[model samples]
Target: MPTYPAFRIHQDAQGHHAGIEQLPRPTPAAGEVLIRVGWSGVNYKDALAGTGRGKILRTFPLVGGADAAGVVEQSAHPCYQNGEAVVVTGWGLTHDHDGGFAGYLCCPAEWLVPIPDGLDPRRAGIFGTAGLTAALAVHRMLVNGQEPGLGPILVTGASGGVGAMAVAILARLGFSVSAVSGKPELTDWLRHLGAAEVLPREALAGATRPLEKARWGGAVDNVGGELLAQITRTIAPGGNIAAIGLVGGHELHTTVMPFILRGASLLGCNSVDIPYPLRRTLWNHLASDWQPPDLEALVSETVALEGLPPVFEDMLAGRTHGRVLVAL
Candidate 1:
């Protein structure tokens, strides 16, 4: 049997654990394609799955990566051919099925999106799930009528993967961005990603008001709970707020005054279940105009399969910086 290296997660008497191992080659079922993965990325959910905090693994002994870019080694479908470049992300990856951390990947042809022209596999993996989610959030906000002339846009958790991408993309689209983060050390980095201003995390912390001073024209919020409530309250009249993550907390405490009085909108973003065609369209944009000028600056580092465990720990502790790409 053909052999390849993979990072596999296993449960034991001590608890869950993960590491690199040599595995038998994967076979693609009909309608599926087999890819020789060139690069993958570490995500927040992947960190959770690697540990046991988020219950992200529906099956144990699973490969753990949500994003991958590579070349198709074999295909059983008409839409794709051998030696084509492709990307795979979302839709039960690293959860219900084996995922991208392995050297080889097998998934349905429909799950694969062609690596757009001018985009290489490594850069595609750099963007990975984080960039895709950021693009989707921005698209939804614009569709909901967020315009460049609306006023300053706010991005919470602005040092993170999603936050960094959101800031860069929003700035590229011509909106001024006010980035909110607790990490004072990331100020320079946030500005490099195109944030117009940086706000201290305390700015959104422990607020009791149902409504605060209306500040942002619109906002991309990656922190839930009080922060989300703050965004809803502080957003300008007729503005949009894209709600994405729950890193701060899950429980949100606030009145409906902002939504009812200002006509503000709270848009929930779930990138995982997005339709395939829409995801592909986003990839096209990422490779073209929507691609950030400083996309490479967002990557903290690229690690090998064995380095994932420590990286996962740092991510869970909120101690890591931007994206972490895994070199297969």
Candidate 2:
């Protein structure tokens, strides 16, 4: 059997361990596609699972990756054929099933989306789950009545991958974006990416009470602890808050005063397992109207399969920013 490189994670009496190893290439079963994965992206969830810092995987001894962009090498489904470019994110990758950290990804054909006309596999990998989640957040907010005229949009944790993507996408859509990031070193970079202003981590600290002066039109919250609670109080009346990510904390403790008195809406964005139709629509937008002016600007670093371990450590330690691409 031909073998290929994979980032395999294992847990036993020795605890969590992950590194590159070789695995046999698999043939596609019914309704499945085998992809020659060209590129993949690292995410916070990937870091958590790789490092055993969070409960992300249902089982161990599995390949670990959340996003992949590649070309089909074999297909057992009618929708895909050999040499077709595709992307897959969020679904079962790195959760229960073996993921895209290998030289090949054998997944259900339904999990694959044809790469849009404007994007190649590398560019698609840059978007990955981060861009998808950001797109979903914007979609939910727009459907709930978010607009440039409402107020400035606030993007919490703006230096991270999803936050940066949200800032660029929101700016491209003509909304004045106020990015909240603790990394002051990237303030100019954030401004270049279309943030009208960059605020420090302490900016929202004043919103400690049940309610504060409503300053934001809406918010894309990537940090889901007290910051989410604070956003509930500060969002404008009739505004929508797209809640995504739980890096800060998962538990939510907030009164219903904002919803009852201000008509504020908190929309949950689950990028994982989104319906296929909406997934196609979001990718189309990312390729065109909602596409960022500089997709290349979001790339923080690029590494091969052997280089993923240190990247995961940096990501979990809050030292990494923007998108990290893994070239297979």
Cα TM-score of candidate 1: 0.97
Q: Model 2: per-residue lDDT, tens digit, 160-240?
A: 999999999999999999999999999999998999999998989868777789999999999999889989989899899
Scored against the true structure, residue 168 in model 1 reaches a CA lDDT of: 91
Residue lDDT tens for model 1, 1-328 = 9899999888768688788889999778899999999999999999998877788988888888999899999999898989999998888799888899999999888888999997999999988889999999998998899986767999998888899889998988889999998899999998998999999988765556777788889999998987887778788888999988998799988789989998898888888878988998899989988888888999998899989888989998989878999998
lDDT, model 2: 0.94
> lDDT (CA) for every model shown?
0.89, 0.94
TM-score of each: 0.97, 0.98
Instruction: State which candidate has the highest lDDT.
Output: 2
Worst 10 residues of 2 by lDDT: 203-212
> Which 10-residue window of candidate 1 scores lowest in summed lDDT?
203-212
Angstrom error at residue 51, model 2: 1.3
Error of 2 at 302 (Å): 0.3
